[model samples]
Target chain A: MSQKILTRMGDGERLAMDAQEIRDDIRRGTAEAARRAGVPELTEAEQEELFAILAEPGRIVSVEPGREVIVTDDGCSMSFYSGQDGGGVGAPLSRLQAVLTYERACGADTTSMGHSDYSYKPVKPIINFEANDYYNISQVTTAPFLYGAQPNMGLYFQPDGPCANAAELMPLGKIDEARAAQEEACEHLRRDLVFVGRRLAEVGLEGLNFDTCGSAGDADYLAALQAVEELKKDLPDLPIIMGGAGEFVLGMHGGVEYQGRRLAGLYPHEQVKVAEAAGVDIYGVAVSTATTESVAWNLARAVTFVKAASEASSIPVHANVGMGVCGVPMMEQPPIDAVTRVSKALVQIGKADGL
Target chain B: MSEALFQASVDAVVRGDAKKAEELARQGLAEGIEPLVLINQAFVPGINQVGEMFGAGKLFLPELIMSAKAMQAATDIINAAIPEGNAQEGRGRFVIGTVEGDVHDIGKTIVVALLKANGFEVLDLGRDVPTDRLIEEADKFNAHIIGTSALLTTTMPAQQKLEEALKKAGLKGRFKTMVGGAPVTERWAKKIGADGFAEDAGAAVVVAKQLLATN
Candidate 1:
């Protein structure tokens, strides 16, 4: 269930909590703890205390069928929807929800679903991050109406833990088990999409974006794509967006000569031919300057890839920055500025309308 | 003749044929080729090349996995034939795992393979390992370095917890600490008292080696 907790108190009243304020408090707490440790590092005790403060959102004061009020022990109460936003689960999703709500308030046109680094939460069972699943949608109930933007669910295909460890285990002749795990993951992706689609519709979400790190074999990719195609039948109203690195997408289509070298992938034009045939609504090209030595070069490269994808696809195309190259807590004081610059360039130069 | 056989062993791994790689190792043994030669000259070189191909996007996970299997098949046979302590000589013992509350292990698994390929005696504790488990394993293995990977920003603090746990247990400075993951930054590592942080597998191997130097 999605539930929001009131964290801070105002002048004898509760104020609407802000994601940035929460982050700032955590950062300041960590820094102060580090300073008190006298070694420029936070002690484990201090670290745990900080994380607890970050993760804990106080206690429930009142509860109804769909909404509730959660009050900190300090007497500050935050009213939230218990069933819509992931209120009681923990701080990660709640914090992310607050951020998305803030972004919508700031006139952002698109609310990209999923976290920067995507992992299938149920498949691994170890990752408990907030940007995890559709059930976390209670946090963004008003995004569609607020921003006039369709919510996009960015589905991650890679499975971690034993499933991902299959690659390592295979070298030791442990193929069957890992292969079965991989297959199980594909099946999970297949089955979950339908449930996720139904749940998103309940929350009024309208778009589906496919995302993968491109480590899976061709068979795994095929299985995921087939699952997607099947889900499309059920949710034909939802537009689908195909997203990944340029090389992997092109390779899946055919082969392409990149930088005078024939890589094992199709050229941009040829790739779009396959995408259009598969009924892709939009093509998202991951453009990053992580490999480039300078900011100007990175922007230039981002523009080049975005333009290429826009021209290649008959449908709308968008840009995903670096495809998880940059680390998390990305929407912050500094990185947010970079995101603003790059996003503007993407829309202006690439002739893209959304991100 | 021995050089030709060793070269064939490399080819077997590059081609990702487990049966062929195992057969070549047995063949080299029968032909009186040094087991060390089979590992250093044949298996290591092939896996290294595979890592390069993977980084460059020329190779996918399937091929990389197959090559690792080929390399392992040969390495297992050669390791069994060689003296136990001899195989570990000149290599530092490294223990790694994903911290508690985070189960992401793909990146950690890659780092393990690269560390093993680079001559480190790597003990992968797998994902969702608690701080106590890591500490216990490090003690059991007499590890020179302990590493943690946390893919979620929420779990990233566990790295710091592990560091603090080490200090509380009087094990601080006894083992070098390394932290990494998609959400991990160099600043975070420094704040948490980590000896090193790597962005990916290749950089991880380099950082692990550098940490060993300081340790």
Candidate 2:
């Protein structure tokens, strides 16, 4: 009911502020709701900084070339957007700079180029454009590069990047060109993966993560899976974590509805199926808590969805829970308690799944 | 043969083949089937089945959207055959869009399809639409209801701004305003002074009809 704090901020500033504020709000509300619902909340320290728990020192297993390594520690991960979280393409500038800053402020086990950072733009690779200099580092690195957490880099490989409209991706030119366009998209992604991987490895990065839910259809989704598999072939030692939809919103804070009924917005199970085929180490369900129902209610719903996903899959499952309201024409950060409750529920589900 | 043509029309939509659905519609028209009857018999039933299957989780988004697209294609062909002056009186006009600063449109698109299927004439303004533009379009279309969707907290304020803009333009009560999206709760709709709020696309139709009755 409060006037949105976002209305007063500049475009980029408002996006970052809104995302953080909504996150803060969800965290706060979820914490309180957990108390009422008899669900445990994150510890104060964990609440203060999530990556502290995620970035705990673990023995590094050497990843041999041409052999794939499974990431046992999925770790508590947060998926962010560049413009919304600050930094990246369409944002103020260097997303890696912002990532380092964020890690310094809040410990981060994984450095991910939020969906906004790598939204596929035709004829341009945002990663190369944004993180041009730090693509590769000369020495192997460990934790505390920018923050308290050990660093692992994650980027997105959307078949149709969130920025690229699906209609545009629909083949319009000559038949062969359209076929070539699809192949070109897959090739571009394969190259992007290799490019980012080599660049991060040069800087001593330990692992890789892929958020692959925004793209539609079996073909695009399967293509993304193949790209991940191909990338793994090239970097067998790097622990690869794959993310897809767990439910309707995929926690992207975008509208995902069909008919009067709310459809599972993303193909979580299908994505996991391909990911399993691709030998992805960890599968993440990105469920947003921005439903019209109470955050507790949505968390409960997410529990059911994640449980089904975990039960149906052979891999370790993690829930990328966030507070994104997709129904309202506009919204602000959800209460912080809501975020914590969803986090707690995710943690519960993760444990139940034996992750 | 008539039954076969109608069944094929239904099959085309269920299969989400837009070209085939359009083709079947043309074939049905050539066979002297009434346009409205084709819509009522085949198009409506096809979309309804899609809705049922989708609700039951047998069908997912790709199929659901394709079916909707197929329905639209058939509807377009049917509408073109009907004379312009043959208007259905009392069916409400609904103008809908995703609020500015939020470019997500799946929810709005679904709502548009549902509205059209339920007999409302719609002007879908697409996504990231400005508040003023929605009001402008609503007025231009003489809409009975203006539905706004916002997918992000950052863009949600635009819904409130739209409500305020309508009041400022002294046209607040002229159109019934409904607000929805991922973050929108009934409480937020009430806070924003919206006339109605539906949690999802199905409820939207029921609520839109209710709002029209009172209006």
Candidate 3:
């Protein structure tokens, strides 16, 4: 009864239609109408005109099977969870950097993942700015992500908020109701979605992220799926990601913290596979259950799982290892230390001798 | 119940057992171990580790929050018992809330829990709290600290307005003010005439105490 879309494009293509090289081809497609209606590129006026012509590539309408793009955001308000890479005023700075770096490395687009300080996006007066101009500008104003559609969970839940109104989140808890919680979370999610979507159109955001969709799984995974799907209907050109695994992984529910490690219920990963079956392009695997070992090992497992899952449909997979709160369960970024860096180099290097 | 019952009790909390944590906390007195020792040494420490994990980024929000609730059940039982006597007190009384036009409580709730564990008497006004309501509660409780939260970029100015109103109402110099949440910064606090700023609740307890000591 439900519909599904294929994730891979013809013959494993990777951004063959870039902005600078094939302006006319990009401008003539579905990306064009969306471009004209989206945010403007900051540095270029000529390109801004052309941006309106590009058909945004990641049309993530729902969890329905299809070509999937992803966006990653590390919530700054909840910076308490960022582990070794965190602490102080630098939390947001690190989070944005992670977003940019993660997106670049993992290859996601259409991001509304973390704090929005516009570190990369500068605010210039729209001079010769026409209110009635026919053209749209898509520029990479900030990091390639946005955190909340409305209330960043970073601000709302993290003890360090300039926060969103609480009543707005009444829906996240009411997940048992159909479209209620998803619709509720979407109240904020939508606000950010539109703002970020418009910004993506302006910043030339080609892919999209629907990461928050799966967060309400216990309450209702289908609701989460439908929420992102409905959102995709509104935003047909971006990839949508939906995944959540924090509680089950950490063993808060009478769980045993054994041998200095946290473990998870058996079914959460199954839920992830279901999200994929429900038509999602990307699946998030929380391998942090290996809290005894380290975040990298879990990340490697998660990446391996994604590599396996996405291999068949040809969808690109993204692995999420969020920041640590108390700094104990370390999720190293950019692999700072030599030990970490050397291992990370091996990961990226692809085992020349063995392979 | 014998001490063997308590070993299971201790193991349950140590293992992050939700059902067993409550059962163990309820059985602490019957098992002959002093309630305060269980509260301070075992149960509180379990959550403290959870908090440390939260602070260290080894855990995320859903886990931290669930652990907080699980830990609270054990502490709730301990709080009901006869004092095990002789213990160091937590930090002092503090009041926190989101400014008007905001309706988020996650940040406020976290700070309250963090401060409570750290020994602060916290009066949480909940979300969308009015400045006058905050001031009234602060005055009623003779609070030494007041922390305000605002999430919206549109409403961040409410923090300034709260300070100005506090000043106009002649309460500005009376209490220390701390502002936090996403839109706030240490610089923003200085500009708004807030006494201090902490980015998260764990750090908030420390900052609130330090500000209270100076004031």
Residues B143-214, model 2: lDDT tens digits: 999999986656778989988999999999899999888667676788889999887777898899899988
> Which 10-residue window of candidate 3 chain A scores lowest in summed lDDT?
A346-355
Q: Given candidate 1, what's the lDDT at residue A261? A: 39
Please identify model 1 stretches exceeding 4 Å from their true place. A1-105, A110-172, A198-205, A210-224, A245-275, A287-308, A322-333, A344-353, B1-9, B22-43, B73-88, B117-119, B213-215
Q: Return the TM-score for each candidate structure.
A: 0.63, 0.61, 0.45
Q: Model 1 over residues B120-201: C-alpha lDDT tens digits?
A: 7888887789999999999999999999998666788899999999999999889999888765767678888989888677
Ten contiguous residues with the weakest lDDT in model 3 chain B: B56-65
DockQ of each: 0.13, 0.15, 0.03
For DockQ, candidate 2 versus 3, the one ahead is: 2
Kindly report the fnat of each predicted structure, to 2 decimals: 0.07, 0.13, 0.00
Error of 2 at A97 (Å): 9.8
Better of 2 and 3 by TM-score: 2
> For candidate 1, lDDT tens digit of each residue in A1-355?
3344343221112233344444444345334322322213333453333333323443322122432111101000001111211112223334345435444555444344443233333422322332244435535544331101111111232333223445446434465655555555555555554444445555545555555423343333443355456767777776666654433331211122323333333323334445555566665555322321222224434444445556656776656553232110221122433344444445555445345
Task: State the C-alpha lDDT per candidate.
Answer: 0.54, 0.54, 0.46
Model 3 over residues A1-355: C-alpha lDDT tens digits? 3322221111111233334433333223213212322312122342343232222233321222432234344343333334322332344443335444444554544334323322111111221221111022123324334333212333312233233333223212221232233334334433444444455444444444444332222222333444445546656665555544432332212122222223323223343455554455555433222222222222223323333333333333344444321111332222222122222211232110100
Top-down TM-score ranking: 1, 2, 3
Show where candidate 3 strays beyond 4 Å: A1-224, A227-355, B1-36, B53-92, B112-122, B163-174, B190-196, B205-215
